[model samples]
Target: MTIHTGHPFADPDPDPARRLRGRVVGAVTLWTAGDRADRTGLTVTSLMVALGPEPRVLALLDPDSDLLAGVRETGRAVVQVLTWGDRQLAEAFAGTAPAPGGPFRQAEFVATSYGPRLATTTTYADVSLVGEREVGWSVEVEATLDAIIVGDDADRPLLHRRGRFHTI
Candidate 1:
């Protein structure tokens, strides 16, 4: 038997791996794909940077999500870093909450070759799908960064850990 240490993201049972990941904080974002009548997106925390001269991007998307379907069909997407004020919008895309005028209404977006990106995003990347594979419960995607847009509020980022939102 092991002694229990009560930490916010700690596991009560044997699955320490998942609980530990819950403690590894991540920036939150809305990952969008397609355009106009075909647009789809989701709140994402599983995005990561692939280091090199030109940094590539990787993300694990739900295999069944509309955003994944759109990305798989169109081979394009937008990764827009969210701000602290975007909790509601994130939740809406996460399907845990509702948005009054749907998720897109919460923020303004502009079209790009990869999809619609948040107009106010301090950092956004337009990506073209380079590769994809089935990984557990997700569709793991590798994408080439086609373009990047940076805005004014670069320091403020929306983050997630312990199953809740935070700011930095």
Candidate 2:
């Protein structure tokens, strides 16, 4: 039987799984939606692209984040892969850095039927929300591919591991 170890909140290592998960490397991305009037977006490293019976984009998104709301209201989003040069933009979207016109100011995007696609990035996808389920503090989203744009920079992608960014 597992024994209780004081209050979960009081413990320093509240979730050892988080530390372990941090060791896993993930590609950095920016998930965005809505228009400039009501635009919202966030940095993400939990995006997974699965190509099987049906192409899908699976991701973990903060329930309270503007991006989530934008997806809900607009029914679409654009997922853009990032490069090492996008580090500052990532921080701004993560809410750890300041951006003058909000996080959207960190980068430019073009309007698409699916949502706002990041203008500078060559690799990005226009997706439509297909399914979703709540997972703890975040929402697990599954989206269907509406359109995909690929460019030459697919080789260079930003990676996150052990709390910092790395690139090949």
Per-model TM against the reference: 0.86, 0.88
- In the range 22-58, model 2's lDDT, one tens digit per residue, is 8999999998888767878889998788998779999
Best by TM-score: 2
The ten-residue window of minimal lDDT in model 2 covers 5-14
RMSD of each: 4.5, 5.9
Return the TM-score for candidate 2, rounded to 2 decimals.
0.88
- Cα lDDT listed for each candidate: 0.86, 0.86
Candidate 1: worst 10 consecutive residues by lDDT? 3-12
